[model samples]
Target: MPFIPHTDDDIAAMLQTIGAPSIEALFDEIPAALRSGERDEIPPALSEQAITRLMRLRAQGDEQPSCFIGAGAYDHYIPAAVWQIATRGEYYSAYTPYQAEASQGTLQVLYEFQSMMTALTALDASNTSLYDGATALAEALLMAVRANRRCKSKRVLIPRALHPFYRRTVRTIVEPQGLELIEVDFDAASGQTPVERCAALAGDQGLAAVVINQPNFFGVLEAVDALTDWAHEQGALAVAVVNPLALALLTPPGEWGAAGADIACGEAQPFGMPLSSGGPYAGFLCSKQALVRQMPGRIVGRTLDADGKPGFTLTLQAREQHIRRSKATSNICTNQGLMVTAATIHLALLGTEGLEQVARTCHANTARLCDQLCALPGVERAFSGAVFHEQALRLPQAPNTVLERLASEADLLGGCALGEHYPELDDMLLVCATEQRTEEEMQRYATALATILNAA
Candidate 1:
């Protein structure tokens, strides 16, 4: 009976404790139309061996050749050491360190992750972690409103070139809070947000924040200093969502001005995490010391233990959901611990030089791919701008049809089509080339794309 985990008697007893006759009674509040009216066709049970075989067959059918998709998730190489270390039982099963003494190791890793993020963003402080880049941007906008004392004129300006998901996330979070979301146009020629136009828009709105992505969604780096100054003059906070790996070659958002960015947030998937079909990735949020109090997630701090030895503790609990309840800075309950640990270990393994090498290879590989793609008959750069690992190109034919042909006929993943988001870019394809991409891979991609276009 115990092997069943929840026997009929146990379920009845539990339901009795809750004053419910049956499980169906618990769902009375749910709308009738939304509830499932019937059961699925799956068998009630199967032997362990049969289940294993069925799962394996399904997995085998799902496997495909190596892909080149990088709309946001990338296909970079993850070292064996990353999985080897992360899979250790202690780390794999650990929960949040509510008590610092019992969680010294986890706390220390979080503390180090915070430190590493600070160095990467060149900011004074960083929280342990966030849900992901999109949520982090949402939290950052909320933090800006908090820092500005919930001014009615609080407006957050986002660049058109920022990740589409991040834009939607911010809108979702801010609109409910009565905060204004202003979308600024990017220079179509350069794929960069025109700071002058942004400055002109910032006039007297009591703007709370201005967000721009470095090596933006199109992979074009924005003029951070100009944008930062413009935002500051309008009494607004400057937030930059940066690519963690790209920070190795470019100046961090923190270095844009004297104290750097008011808040710097970005996806940490490039570190050691996998695409895993777009998640579960980690997001990092960093800010100057002055604004550390306004950071949404947990903050790990160093302290001295009873033995007078250096120890780590989760500091700044006042900013979290438990302490503040509905009044908390953010309702983000769980920090992405496993992913954070992987990133910390990955960064440690790379050190300073290794990160730079990764960044350099990304740039070089992208440049090579861009050149080859541009030489195709009807393919051209979408924007005549400097870029990093990803670039956009205009194709003569419909991007979606061309992409389908590339995948079906040429056995390629092809590039992300832009028509879904930008109507004018119906024929544009967004492609990315990382360190994992070789010269041969680049050539194959170009040849496949060109062949598809010519045939079409």
Candidate 2:
């Protein structure tokens, strides 16, 4: 039997109290056409068993060919233990820990996450987490502006090779705040932003920060040290949007120079987090201790209990909205807790050596793929700079046509075409290679691409 909450008299009485003759009268303000004028000509709801069978059939029909795409989101391996622990009722349903005194477990996990990120970035401290890499970068730019005392030097230099979405996000956040964004061009041959060229733009006194990506959008490593030095010499902060996986093999941004990096931000999607379409991913923000007060999100810290046992609690939250109104450093209240938890577990499971192995595999796979593609008759390297896992290849044929043909005729997912974002590279395709891809799969891609280009 259907359980009804309101009887006819009860609804009528409630409607009368609001001076409405009937329930339908409450919606009179809505236009007649906009209302549910025509009922959905549909079938009745099905039983649970029938619904399950129908859903399974739909899922099967929607399955696609194997994927080889990874622009920002990747297809990496996640250990069973990660889901096993993350699915615990307590962890899955946990909410923000308002009262630290009774939330030791949640606080401790967050504290460990912060510590892990700090150690990885080789920075003094890190926040709990943020929405994703793009927003973290946006917040970092804002922090640089505030740290510089909101000087007239509100100009931010973003390298042209940074991810297109991230660049747009930074502009969206800062343009309304009266901040100026200047995009510096990268050498097409080197795929690295020319530091000297950028230095020329650093006039006397209006450059707040310079933002560059490590292993930039084209997958080529930038001359970060030179760029960081030039920015600091001009009294501007250096912000890097990094890939956490590459940090395992390359030098951390904090070690670039004395004034080093004022802030480091990046996507943590490669860290055992599933590419659930594009997100529900975590972003990490780390900076020197001097700028902690202006840092964006909540940070978890370790402490001692009343019994002198090791405990945890939310620390340095005075900069948040609840504590300071308009003066708050950031209005970001909650974080990606479950995602952060997954990252924490994945990092713990991998440890130091295991992470290095993962990085090595990704690098090796990418090198192999690059070599094969370069050897093809119509394919060549877009840039000569050293890369980690992804690379851009210049093709003789239109990349979009080739990609469509590859998907439809060959039943294979292809790389992202650069023409969609940068018209200058109409025939360039950006491809990624992860540890999950087998050698057989790489060979298949190579043969299919070669055949398609030859036909074109």
Candidate 3:
């Protein structure tokens, strides 16, 4: 059925009943001086076929190639059922569960998402969301400062190996609050955060927190356990910025050290979301029990009403966006409901074994590709440290130029060039291969990269 409410005759009858001359007359209470005339800028409405053709032409220009880029947004295979069910009227149409009773479905879905995230992070509690991974890290950093009442200064220790965009975002969000982000340089040989360097920076800084990535931006696994301990020894809270998919195969933040990470946050996009250009990706923030109240975003709780039936409802309803201005835990506007819904379904379908398989497959594929590609001339791994699914490789030519050639000439995305962000890594390209990538795809990438490098 058409969504348009009433026919012209019905609208006329209703207008007559309402004692209004016409629809425009009903709004005559406003001044005529404020009214703007019809717009000539808007083109005449095109037929459905014309609109479809136009859109198709535009889409053809941006069709996805054989993707190898994974700076932050990853290309993953989402099951068809994930969206078909998520887009259903019951799940898709619902908004935030402001009223506990009316928004039970939304509340339950959020609750499930939180539970799954907590399990993935091994943290005591998980907030429904933040804006995205970068902002999520910022919020987690803020929570760390608030949670550590004993800490006097609002200084956060960040590793240079963390995602460049994430670092920029954290600075944008937290710098104005008098929080100093001390970026500790990574080890030249390993591409991992140098624990000693960070330890020295945290020394006597009265640091509120230390942020670390599991697999740093170069995809080299950091010495998380030692680093977590070092941060605690310096009397700073450890906040982990991680990749959710990597956690399935690696140690989770909460299990990092003897004390565990006080907070954890990361992009949940790889769970099922596609790299639709960059995003609409969900950011997950999880923290220990002591830091729950200081965490951002909404939390849903399972409860039973007086009737004795089980139910779900919104909890910690005291966020600043909702009401309490100065006392709010976070100023985030809204949650990524659609993305979370899809992620929740993806997780449910891919249980522990399935998730592990996917992670292992990605690692195996990446290792295979790296070994094969490194055998070729002028291609070598940038770091000697153990890596995950993604790795940075020093290219023979300018990374951006080569990547462009690969994309335009060979129909391959190849990888993200690191030189722009980290000028020291002049010819490095960070490449990622997930479970979605076939062996043929990996070989093709290697062959093309070798051919490009070996050319005159």
Candidate 3, 228-249: lDDT as tens digits: 9988987899999999999888
Ordered by TM-score, highest first, the candidates read 3, 1, 2
Q: What tens-digit string does per-residue lDDT give for candidate 1 at 171-213?
A: 8877898878888989989888998878767757578888868
Model 3 ranges off by over 4 Å: 1-3, 47-49
* TM-score, candidate number 2: 0.89
Model 1 residue 58 lDDT?
Answer: 91
lDDT of 3: 0.87
Residue pairs whose backbone atoms clash in candidate 1: 254-260
What does each candidate score in C-alpha RMSD? Answer: 4.3, 4.4, 1.8
Top-lDDT candidate index = 3
Error of 3 at 163 (Å): 0.7
lDDT of all predictions: 0.85, 0.85, 0.87
